[model samples]
Each structure stands twice: as structure tokens, then as C-alpha cells.
Target: MTHPFGFNYGGKTHYFVFDSESGSLHNVDYVTFLCVKNRLSIPFEGGEAEDFRALEKEEIDEINAELDQLASQGVLDSPCTVTQKKKRTGEIKALCLHICHDCNLRCRYCFADEGTYRTADKAHMPVEVGLRAVDFLIANSGKRKSLEIDFFGGEPLMNMTTVKAVVEYARSLEASTGKTFSFTMTTNCLLLNEENRKWLNDNMYNVVLSIDGRREIHNAVRKTPSGADAFDVILNNALEFRKIRGDKSYYVRGTFTAKNLDFCNDVLYLNDCGFDQISMEPVVTDLPDLQIKKEHLPVIFKEYEKLAAAYIDRRKNKDTWFNFFHFMYDLEGGPCVVKRLTGCGSGCEYLAVTPRGDIYPCHQFAERKPYKMGNVLQGVSYDRNVSDVFAGNIVTNKPDCTDCPAKYYCSGGCVANNLNFAGDMNKPYDISCAMMRKRFELSLAIAAIEACEG
Candidate 1:
């Protein structure tokens, strides 16, 4: 019912319409915007309506007719639904390999249990294990010529030898197997020394550097085991890495929590740090003091608005511009219906391999024994019940998402988060859902401003 979202942004100089049904943004004049937004005759009256005083009845009627025509074309709030493609079966396209279940930093929000992943012994993935994982991806790829391998971990660089071996092995088979491999690594960058940074720049398709914003805020939660400041080292290394990386894809990723409700400043700080591509995510945790509650939504929403306004300013002034990951919405030719319906293809097309070679739905579900699909050595052999559950929990199948205004935009959100919060994959975490909806609105608004300004 909310397909066409109408709003005023950019200090109210821009009135825009976002057609979610078609993934289109339209920059509209005041009269037309008012017609679609009010869904009735004009509301202007008195001296405040002076600018529109000369608009004849016939002009108003004509604008109404145009709006009606747009609605019928599914570029407005059309009743028609997008057809969901049949559920995908076996064709793994991406793998997150846990290179090591160990890390150098002791981040307070470390979900991997300070690098052990809840395991007693922090272990580095054996070189053979990493090689086997590459082979496993190649063998089960099923016509997927371009495959993705993300070297993930408590810290992937901890197992540099294994990572290099896997990449080399995967590359060795490219010509013979008629397949190509792209690599991505997510690291804290403490180990991004000269040699390692050079090698990563040459091989990785993308690199994710972890740093919280502002020195004080970052050092508050993220530090070395010896309780020393970890921010400076990581920041310096990230800058160095970016200098040599040329134009390849990389982002400085940060996390916001209850401690940092005023997170907009952190985002701006990252932008000022010379990292052009950036992502700032809310921390997902069960720790009561750190959890984002309903009361925090208003503050968070306000921060988002501040960010959006800054985004608009940056877009207009190119010198201070940076890409905020959450706001990067492709309004033209987005993913197909199947991709939208199935979310990230976590348990299906994408799976994570732990340091021990065990496969799980994704990295977040790595140590959870019940979700284990199988191991790289044996291939995917596990309970059909788990697979069926994953296949059935598409956006269309999720009761909560079926009628949501942002269903197609978010695709039912993160499955792991849903499971952890709502205790069901089909049920979304309300906090995340709210944040996502607000982000979608702001993203559309930002796009609308750009479209109009251009």
C-alpha cells in the first residue's frame, strides 16, 4: 500500500516521489507533489497559497489525471505485486572462509568471542583446510564462472600463509576450470604491514578496514590485549593501504552502540579521515546495557536525518564527498525479484566455512552447532530440515515482511539477526526493521535531491 513514498527534504526545497514498485524517483513540482501526497484536491488557502493563486481549476484537474495515470502504470502505489521466482536450489556463489579463529585486538563488541569464536583454543585454519575450501567452492559452484571468496576471521591476516595458499590454489585452476575468482578480506588492519598491504592490494577485489570513528570513541571499546590504544595503528595502516590501493574497492567500517547514540559525529569523523568509502552499522548484541531499545529510535532517526542532510551537502560539494554504505541504493535496475525475495542467499547460495572446515549458514552462525550444514572435506551433507527451513523463509514467505512497505527493499533483513532476536528466521528484529525503513526513506530522499539538482 505504501509503494509510492512522498516526502519533502533538503530544507523543503525538494518535493519528491519514490515509486518502490518500480524503484524510481521523480522530482515533482509543489502542486503535483501535494496532489499525490494529499490524495485529494489542493489544500492551499489564504495568503500562504499566493503562489498557487493563479492555478486554474482545469490545471488542478489535469494534474490529478496525470497522477491517476501514473498509479495505473505501477509507477505509483499500484496494487499489482511483483512475481516471486521459484526457490533456488544448489549453486553456491560465495564463501566466507574463517582464516583464523584468533585476533589481535580485544574489541568489546567482538561477536567472535575475542577471536576464539567460543572455542577454547584459538586456532588458525590449516593450509590444507584453506585449500580444500577453495576446491569445495569450485566443485559445487554449478556454472558460476565468477566466484567470491571472503577471507574472514577473528583476524584473517593472522593466517596470512593459509590465505596466500588458498588464493594461489584458486588462481591455479582458473584457466583449466574456466572459472575466475575474486577475493575480499575484512581486517582490523593491525597486521596490514608494508609487505602484507602490498600483497593484499594486488590480489584482493576488496578490503574492509575496521576502525571506529574519533580516537576517543574508538579507543573506548577497541584495544589491544595489553590494554593499549589500538586506534592509531589501525588508522595509520588503513591510510597507507588506501594510498597504495589505487582505485580498488575498500571501506572503513565502524559500529555504533548504546554508548555512542550520537553516532553522526563518528560518521563525519570517518569522512574527515580521508576514507571515501565507509559503512557504520549499529551493534547487534544481547548485552542489556548496549542494546538499542524503542526509546532510542527517535534519537537514531534524528541522527539519520543529520547524516542525510550532510550527504546532500557532500553530493553538492564534491571536495568533501564520501559514500555512506547504507545510503547506496540503486534506484535503476536493482536486483531481480528472486534476489529481493531471498535476501542475501545466506544459507543457500552463500555459506561460511569455519577454521575447522565446518560449514554454517554464514559467518554469524559459524559456531552454532545446530546450524552446521557440513564440512568442506565432505561437501554439503546435513539435515534437509535446515535447508528446507532456509528455502522457505523468503521475503514472500515471511508473514511479517509480506505486507511491509519496505519488504522488497530490505528482503526480510538479516536471517541470523532474525533468528537471534525473534527466535525465528521469518520474523524480523523490530529495531533493525525500523532502522532499515528510516534509512530507505532517507536514501530515497537523498536520491530525489540529486535527481532534481542534476
Candidate 2:
């Protein structure tokens, strides 16, 4: 049986019981918190007995009665059963187009191996191939009227010509095809000059600038091929782009590694740089020293708590407000049921296309031959076996995620990360899962704090 998960949080100011299945959050007093947290059938004091007030027998009976009422109302300690969704193919919604498999800077921990993807030399997507990709997206989009194409790579700016061509080609077809195209691009800012900046600001719906927080933090890994720090150039370019970006959406995305356990400073640093929409993701790598280990969980958890509190403080002040991508969770409205079941739609609705037209489940899975679903010319050629596997990769189908309280929130985690680390797409990396759970807990606590403040 799936019961409500209760925990004492909010700096001891509040206790919460989160209903994972139904998405209900309950704020209870200390006694009720204990009753629900311990899953006691009858009110009993054992854990936290010393910390909590001594309960009289009559008070315990009242608590038990309240618990029974909640249980009967299906609000507490409720049973949950999830049915596995049947395998099926769906229309593609988005594509991450690797416009160039080359980068100007050489990042030490680049999963793409400095844009070569382990290849001997860099490559760029030809304009013809890009046009074909646009056509492929339009043709395969089916009844979907809105389509998204993200220009990704070691650095898309390396082949800015093809990026612009693909955008124009897709835009030309929108009227005839009765479809709307939204473009997004991720760049390192090395080539974000005046000419391209103006074009991108006008055409691109959203832009993601890659900057790893503080100067030392960013310069430590991201640097020019000449082995010189490119932090100043990238920061200046990003600031310029942000100014011209007007109201169009953009994110100053950063990656935190084991070296920066106090990554909250990085987030705040980005915010101080005038980039309000910020995202700081943990680096996923196999490098021994860079990998976040089991011993690091406590520090990481503390850092997350620190970030959450600062985020709450900022939100309380209108002038100093900013958005942290990870902490932005909508409790009242979230992803659709289908999205929650299928996770990120990787290897299915959302696929990544390499410069050479090879398709992978997502950008992280790109260049991995075994995960090559197919090519853009022929479209996704996922065999029935592979298709069925991806189709059935739901939280309910995963043993580890079946009972996880964060299942719905994370949607089985990232499939590409799962395949790379766990050797199974359905299985999640335990460390990542733990971090995600902590984030979820803190997000809920923050929400409660906000509600209380209001």
C-alpha cells in the first residue's frame, strides 16, 4: 500500500504529509505529524517522544480519531495502484538538432569530448541536411500544429549559417503546413557576434547560454582551444545577448560538479550577473575525481537547502526575484498524465539528430552507436523490440521507481542518464534519484512556506 509520506520540515515551523499519488499536501500539528509519519494505526508516542510534548491518553485518542477520519476520507495512508501504459508510437513533438559536432572551447568534462564526439575531427551539419531535417520534422509532426526544434551541439554557433537556413526553411513551410515552428538554441557565446546576435534575438524563441557560475568555476573547465580563459568573452557576449533578447525567453544555464559543492553561490552569482532565468545542473560524468560520490550526498543536500532558502527569500522580494529552473515546480498544474508516464519522451517523441543525420534518444545519448535509433533521412527506425521497450519504460514498470514518492515529479528520471550509468534505461542512477528526492522534498516545503507567508 502506498501511504502518505510525512516529514517534519520547515525549520521546525511546520510538518507536512505529502500524498504522492493524489498530489495532496497536508500541514499537521506535531502530534498528527508523528501519527502519520510513523504510520501508526493507534496514536502512540515513541520516536521524537523526548522532543515532542508528553501526550495524555485522551489526546492520543483524539489524534487517532482524526487519523481514522483522514484515512476514511482517503486523504492519509491511502492505497495506490498504477497500471502500466500500453506500448504505442506517438507523433514527434521536439528534436534536438546537433548543428555542429565541434566547439571553439575545450571543456575538460565535456561529454561530447570537446565537440568531436570522440571523432578524429570536428564536423558541421550541411545546409542540405538541415533543410531535410526541417522537412522531416514537418512531415512526421502528424496532426501536431506546434513543433519545436533546438539547435544543439558541441557549439551550434560553429555552423550558424545552417542554423539560420533551417529556421528560414521551417518558417516558410509553416503557413502551408498549418504548423507553428519555435526555435531554440544552446551556445557557448564564443561566436555570438553582433550579426548573429541580432538574427537570433529576432528569430529564436528561446536561447540557452552556457556559463558555469563564477569566473573561477567557469574558467576552470570551459576555456579556449589555446588554453586561455574565455570567461570574460563569454560573459560579455551573454550579457549583450540578454540585453537584446528583450522579453524573449532565455536561460543562463550552468553545470556544477563535485568541485563546487557550494554551488548555491554560483546560482546567486548568475542572478547577480542580471540573468534572472537560471539553471544549475549537476554534471554527469565518469571522471573519478569529478563524479559526485555517495559521501557527497550530505553536502549536496545542504547546498540544495541553502539554495532553496535563498530562492524563497528572493521570491519574497519583487525587485530581487529570479527563477531557478530546478526549484520551479507547479503543484496545482503540471505535465500531462502521458508525460508523467513516459518521462521525457526520449527515444520516442523527442529525438536528437547528429550532424551526420544519425538519431539518438537525446543529446546525451548522441554519438553512442548502440542508441542510434535511425537517421533523419529515413526518420526513426526503432525496431519493434526497441520501440516496445521505450514505450513501456514508465515509472510503474521500473522496480526502483514503483514506490518512490518523487516518481510522478521526476517521471522516471532521464532515460539517457539511466542507460549511460545503470546500463538499463528503466533503472535510475541511485545518486541522482536521491538528489532528486531531496529537491522534491525541499520544493514542497518551500511551497508550504510560501502559502503560509501569503
Candidate 3:
């Protein structure tokens, strides 16, 4: 099933466009490639590729010209040497700043507590450090153009001083660089109060509160330092904040553990609470959480499907839309990018700054010392081991996924997760593959039903 150029497509082939000059391979799906193919041809000039439709003659010519350029550089054979190049729109134009390492609540699933998680000696980042990070971002903003900075935490508000500094700094940077800047925070919401809410409102900051659904489910997993229920205060603050914002963009992030598999009621409950967006992520850790056993996963998947289907139907029928995941799923042309492909911009394009000034690929990879891409002070440096691990698993092919039909879509799964748990990043991402296949199939089914009805 090899395409004319050298792209061998079987079930396992996750399509990627390799820039031989940059040594970077981009993960693009086949559908997107087909769309790209229909849009472009060679021998054209002067216009952004993005503005041109795939079916337009001039756009087609421009695409062919780009392909010819690649071919001249020995990257492709001719204008039609490879499948259509994936469009890198950079839609998720945001950066997550791990501003604080000290958290007030201690969840058992806290990746920070994971033995692999590393931090700088200090638990807080100074205002100057944040300013420098903003500087770095502003300098690189030309490449990305529009970008947003997100304040992430052990509890970001724990050091409100730094948060304020970074926000102000980003604004100043934007003023000087002419780059648009926005702010968001992912927090436990335990420390939020009227004063903080006012500050957030003044700054137009979006807040994503971490709450695990209802009282019992939330209290069971999230707790205060004194082991008391933390939801009461969080809910109160969220209500207060909502009153101030008068918008539905504020979100509640719910994490699902094995224990809460039977918690579909919580989804309805969140909707009743006037929340428009709700995020659900499975509890993933270095060591497999027993709650996410093979048998339990199907149940979890079924629960997600039930909740998502109901939520979508409600939204379509002019019922209240309560689910954030559904909105994210529908907005993107397909399923969530993370759920579909291997490797993200986490390391290469995106870097996470810890409170102590150390940088890692992401929060999850921060815990793993080997995955630390570099430090802020020293600048960006790619570790060969890290690159090799990623290249072997994601950038290159593997024996298990080499011949599989779904390889292109899954991209052999998460390199960091597979490397950490299975001691091999090159192995097949069987778990994620199964999950994505179900999601893709479900989405297609829903689309078909809608088409028939219309």
C-alpha cells in the first residue's frame, strides 16, 4: 500500500511529512492529505498557501511548486512525489507555564509526587524569571504570530505575585511586539476568593477549576491538607467567579479514576450547576493505576460515549450544552489531536517551565528526568536520548505497528508513556489505538446519522 513517493501505507502507517532540511516529521492524517492534494498543483506564485482552497487552480499550482522545491532538495521525487503535506495551522496557539510547584491539596494521582517528577530547588519562580520567559516568548512570537500563555500549577495562585508579574509582563511584551496575548489558569480553586476573582476578572483571565464531578466522587479523590472535603469552597468560588464573568467560558476539569467509573450522573450535575464546559481526562501515571484495568476501560469508554452522545444531542436540539469535550471534539475536523497522533509539540515546539526554572517537554514528562529537554537558563538543547526515543517510536517505524492498518492515525502511541511503562517507545500503542478507533468510528456513525436525517 505504498504511495508513489515512498510513503508505505498499511493499517499501521501514521502519515507524516518529513522535512529533510529541518529533520522534523509532521504527523498528518490521510484525510487531511487528500484534502491538501485536492487543493494544490505546481507553477504558481505570490499568495499564502492557507488562503488558497485545495480545489482552486492557483492553490494547486502553489502546492505543486512547494512540492517541486522539496523534490529539488532531494526530499521528494516530483510535484506528486508524496501525498499532500499536512497543514500546520498552529490552532492551539498556547503555552503552559508551570509557575508554582507547591500545591495546597495532595491528590494521590498528583504527577508531581511521582518519583520521576523533578523540580528546581525552590518551589517558586521569581517575577524576573517570568519576565525572562515572556521575553523569550516575545522574541519567538514572530514565528508563531498569535499566542496565548497559560499559567499552570501545583497551584499557580499559590504564588500570585509571579502570576501577576507574568500577566503584566506578557501584556507589556505584546504591546511592544504587537503579538496578541491571552491568559488562562488551571487550578484547584481552593485558594480563590473575591479578591482573586476580581483580579482575574480585571485581567480577563480564564480559569479552569479542577473538580472531580459530584461531592462524593470529588471528596473521595480530592482533599485538603487536613483531609476535609475541598469541593465546597471550590464550588463557592466558581459560582462567585461566574457571577462576575457573566460568560460560559470558565471550565470545570474532571479527572476520571477507576473508582468513579459509574459516574455519568456527575456530567448531568455539572450541567445543572450552569457550567458550559467540562473536561474529562483519564488518570494516567507512570505505574498503571489499577483503576484503569483492561476490563474497566471498556466501561469507561462506554460511559464517555453515553455522556458525549447525550450532550451532543442536547446541543443540537437547542438543549443546554454542558460538555466541553464534545465542543472540542466537534470543533476540530476530527477527534482530539492528542487522541489521534503520536508526539505533540510538547518538546519540539512547546516547553514547560517549572517553578525552579528547569524546562521539560511537558508536566507529565517533567517527572521523568531523562525526558527533561533542557533548562531555561541554558537555552533549548535536544537530548539525543530523548530524540532517539521519540524518533524510534514516533518519527520512525516499529515492528508491531509497521504493518498495522491504524498505524498512521495512532503514530505508535505516546512515546513517553510507552517508554516509561513498557521500556520501549517503539512498541505499538494498543491502548490508545483501541480508544481512538472507537472514538473515530463513533464520530463517523454520528455524522452518517445526521446526514441521513438532513
What lDDT does candidate 1 reach at residue 430? 94
TM-score of each: 0.91, 0.93, 0.70
Best by lDDT: 1
Clashes of each: 0, 0, 19
- What does candidate 1's lDDT look like per residue over 370-393, in tens digits? 998888877645444565668776
Candidate 2 residue lDDT tens string, 1-454: 2333333344554667777776667777877676564554434445665544476768778887987887788766666655756534557778899998889999888888888888765789988778878777776677989899999998998888899899989989988999999999999998999888898899999999999999999998888999999999999999999898877899999999998989999999988888889999988889887888889999999899889878888887776789888887786788876767877777667778888887777788788887777676676344445555677777877889867878988988888788879999889999899999888887888777777775
The Cα local distance difference test for each model comes to 0.82, 0.81, 0.59
**How displaced is residue 357 in candidate 2, in Å?**
1.2
Model 2, which residues run further than 4 Å from truth?
A: 1-12, 40-49, 86-88, 378-385
- Candidate 1's TM-score reads 0.91
lDDT of 1 at 446: 75
